[model samples]
Target chain A: MAEVNNVVEALKFMALGMGVVFLFLYILVVLVKVQAALIAKYFPENTPKIPTTPVGNTVEDENRRVAAIIAAVSEFRKNKS
Target chain B: MKLKQIFISLLFAMIALTSMSQATGQDATAPVVAEVSTEKKAYEPKTIAELATSFWQTTGINAIFDVNDGETTSEPKGHAYEREMTWFESSLGRIMMILIVFLLFYLAIAKNFEPLLLIPIAFGGLLANIPLAGMGGEHGMLGIIYNMGIANEFFPLLIFMGVGAMTDFGPLLANPKTALLGGAAQFGIFGSLVGAVMIGFDLQSASAISIIGGADGPTSIFIANRLAPDMLGAIAVAAYSYMALVPVIQPPIMRALTSKAERVIVMKTTRQVHRLEKLIFPIVVLVLSILVLPESTPLIGAFAFGNFAKESGVVDRLSDTMQNALINIVTIFLGLGVGSKLAADKFLVLETMGIMIIGLIAFSAGTAAGVIMAKIMNRFSKEPINPLIGAAGVSAVPMSARVVSKVGSEEKPGNVLLMHAMGPNVAGVIGSAVAAGVLLSIFK
Candidate 1:
C-alpha cells in the first residue's frame, strides 16, 4: 500500500535519473570528441616509413632464393636419371 | 627379733601381688569405638531404545523424526508434528536451497558461467546451509569475512580498482559518440526501478535491486550495501547471474531491434589514440563525477586513481599488484561473503523471486535500449553504426563485446566488431557508476 502511494515519486526518480545519466554522458562525449579532433588536427599522426633497399639489392635477394630452388630441382633430376 | 622381721616381709609381698592382680583385671575390658562405612550406588545402563532417543535429541534429528519428547512423548500442541525447532535448523526450504546451490555449481562448472565467482559463491552457499554449522552466524568465519570487507564496501571498491587498471579507454576515445549507447542502457536500471516500486518493494530496496540493470556487479553490491543490506545477497547474485547470462540474454533482444543488414555493417577502424589523451581521460572523468555526484567519489575515485596509475607508466609494480594479487584476494572473500547471505531463512522468500524476475527484465530492457539508441544515432550520422555494437553498452565488459562480435560474425564472417563494441562496453561501466551515483543521491 505504501509502495502504491510512492509510485509517482519513483517514476519521477526514474525519469530524472535516466535524464541525468544521459545528459552527463552526452556532455562527456562532446568534450572527448572535441578534444580528439583538436589533438588530431594539431598533432597529425606520424608513422615512420620503413627504409627500402636499392632495387638491385632487392632483386639480388629474390634471385638468390630462385637460384637455390632451381639448383635443388636440377640436382634431384640428375640423381633420378 | 629375726622371726618377727621375716613374717612382716612375707605379708608385704602378698599385699603387692593382690594389688597387681586387681590392676590387670581392670585393664582386661577395653572400650569399643564404632566404625563408619560409605556405600557405593549401583550403576544402571540405559536401554538401547533410550540411548537412541538420547542420540536423536542431541543431534537435533528429532524435528525430522517427529520426536517431541522421550519414548512416551507426544507431538507438540497446535501442530501435527514437531514444531519447537527453529526454521533455520529444520525446514523443507533448506532442501530447496541446497538444490539451488547445486544448480549454481553446475552452472559454474559445466556451463562455464562466471566460474571464478559462481564456484566460490556456490561453495559458500553449501557451507552456510549445513545444519548446526553456524557458518553464517555472527561469530562464524563467513560472518567475519563479511564484516571485514562486504559490510564496509571495501572488496567491491578494490575490484573497481582492478577493473580500472585493466580497462583501456582508447576505443572510447576513438569513438566518443558510443557513450550515448552506454547512457541509453541505463534505461534498464530506471525501468526496473519503476517495476520494483509497482511490485510493492520500498523505494530504497527497489533502487538497490534495479541497479542490477546496470550490469556492473560491484556497483550493485555497493548500492545494496548502502540502502538495502538485507537484500544484498539476492541483489548481488541476480546482478552476477544476469551478467554471466548476458551472452544468452542480450542477443535475442539485439536481433529483434536491429536489421540483418545493420548487423553486417562494418565500422571504421577506431582512430589511434595519443598518450596525452589517455592520461587526461581518467582525470577529466573523475573531476566531473566528483563535481556532479560527490557520493560517487569512493567508487569513481578508486577507479580513476587506478587508471591514472596504469596510464602514468611510472608505477608498474603498483598497477600490477592492484590488477592481480589485490583483486584476486578481494574477489575470494567477497564471493564467500555474498554466499553467506544464502541462508534459507534469508533467501527463500517472495522478495527473492521478485528480484530474480525484475532483474531479468532489467537486463533485457537495458540491452534493447542500447541497440535502439544506436539505430536512432544512425538516423542522424553519415557513418553507419552497427546497432549490434550497442548491445555491448551494458558493461558486461569483454563478454558483451564478444557477443556483439559473435552476432556480427554470424551475419558476415569477415566482420570484426569486438574492438568497436568495446567503446560502448567501457562507457557502460562509467554510465552505470554514474547511475549508481544518481540512486545514491536519492536514497542516501
Candidate 2:
C-alpha cells in the first residue's frame, strides 16, 4: 500500500504546527497571567487614581458661585480700564 | 463579429506587437551573418532600399515574427535567458506581462488596495518585462537587491522587528485568555496545507502557499523563499492582495459563524498593566520562543529586539528608526525583490491561479476558525466574550482589529471592541510565528 508521501508529510506539519502554536500560546497565557500577578504584588504604581470632584448640594451655593464669577470678571475689567 | 468582418484595429494591434522586440533579433545582430554576402566589402548597403531593409529586420516586429531564427547566446544587451526561450516566447511573454503590470497598478491606485507595496512591485514588474532588457535577470539591479535581502531571509525578519516595535502588547497582557483565539486561527494555515497538497502542489510549495492564511505578508514571503522560491511571486501577490481585502472578506465569514447575541456581547476591560510587566514582556516571549522553537528565533528575536528597544525608554532614537526609516527602506527593496519574480516564466504558470484561490480559502477559513473558537470560549468564560473579537486573530494587525471593532459595534451601539480585539490580534502574530517555526522544523 503506497500512501502518497506528500499527504503524510502535510498531515504531520498540520498536526505538529497547530499543536505547537496552541501549546506555545497556552503557556504564554499562563506566564502572562503569572507575570501580571507578580508585577501587581511587587511593584505597584505609587499614587492611586484621583477621585471625581464632589459638587456642593444647594441652590445658594450655585448662586454664590455665579456671583463670584461675575465679580471676578468685572474687577479684572475695571483694573484693565 | 471578427470572423466575418476584417477588424482594422486588431490588424494594427498585431502589427504593432511584432515591431517592438525584433530590432536586435535579426539582420545586423551578428557579424558573421552580416558578412555572409561575399560580393560587397563589409556588407555596406549601396541602395536606400537595402539600408531600410536591414534596419527593418532589426526591429522588434521582425524578431517576434521570426519563429525559427538562428540561436544567439545573448539578448540584445548581453542578457541571456538561462532557459533558452524562442524569439516568439520571449517577446510575447514580455507583452503579456506588461498588461498584467497595468492591472497591478490599477489595483494599487484606482482600487486603493495595498498601494504602498503594490506600487513598487508593479513598477518593478513593468521594468522586468521590457524586451531584451533582462532587468529581472540574475545580474540585473533588481535581481541583486533580491539576493541581498529576500534571498537571505533578513527582510522579513526586519519587518517583523518593525511590527513588534510599533505593537502595543498591553491589551494582550491584560487578557491572557484571548491568546487562544490567536492559536485557533492558525488552523487555517494547516487546513490550507491539506487542501494545497490535494490540489497537486508538492509539500514544500503547499506549506509556503498555506502560510498565506497568517495574513502577514512578510512571513508568507519568508516561508515561500525558504520552501518554494519558484512560487514566491504568486504567493506574495495573493497574500498582499487578500490582506488588503480582509475588511471585505472577514465580515461575511464572521457573521455566518456567530449568532447576533454573541456578536452583541459586551466585554469588560481588564485591569491596568504595570510598566514593569510591559518591559519584561518581549524578553519572556523571546526566551520562550528560543527554548521551545529555536527555528522561530530569527523572527521572534528580531521582533523582541525591536519591542525591547521601544520599551527600554532610553533608546527612543533606535526605536524610532526601527519603526520608521529602516522599515520603510526595507519595504521598498522587499517589494521590488518580490516583483522580480513576476517575470513571465514564473508568473504566467497555472500554479499562480491555484495559489490565489487557496489564499482566499485560507483567509476565510482563518476568520471562521477564530470566530468558532471565540464562541467556544464564551461557553466556558465567566465574563461575557464577544465572538466578533476572535475574527481579529488572523494577524492582519490593526486592520483586522479595527474591522472586528466596527463589526462588533454594528450589532450593538456603543459596544466598543477595538482594544479587546487587539489582545487576540497581537496573539495571532506570535501564533503564526510559532506555526512557521513548526513547519520549518518539520521540513528542514
Best by TM-score: 2
Per-candidate alpha-carbon RMSD to the true structure? 23.1, 9.5
Question: What share of the reference contacts survives in each candidate?
Answer: 0.54, 0.66
Which residue pairs in candidate 1 collide? none
Clashes (N, CA, C under 3 Å) per candidate = 0, 9
Candidate 1's displacement at residue B251, Å, is: 0.8
CA displacement after TM-score superposition, residue A10 of candidate 2 (Å): 2.0
Candidate 2 achieves a global lDDT of: 0.80
Q: What are the clashing pairs of model 2?
A: B18-B61, B19-B61, B21-B60, B22-B59, B22-B60, B22-B63, B23-B58, B23-B59, B23-B60
Q: Rate the local accuracy (lDDT) of all candidates.
A: 0.79, 0.80
- Candidate 1, residues B73-159, lDDT tens digits: the string is 111111243223344435565677789999999999999999889888877777776655457666677877888888899999999
Candidate 2's residue-wise lDDT over B250-337, tens digit each? 9999999988888888676444567788799999999899899999999889989998888888998898898889989999998898
CAPRI rating of model 2: acceptable
Q: Which residue runs does candidate 1 get wrong by more than 4 Å?
A: A1-4, A37-81, B1-55, B58-89
- lDDT per residue as tens, model 1, A1-81: 566677988889988898989988988888887777677677766422223232246575465434434533453343222
lDDT, residue B398, candidate 1: 68
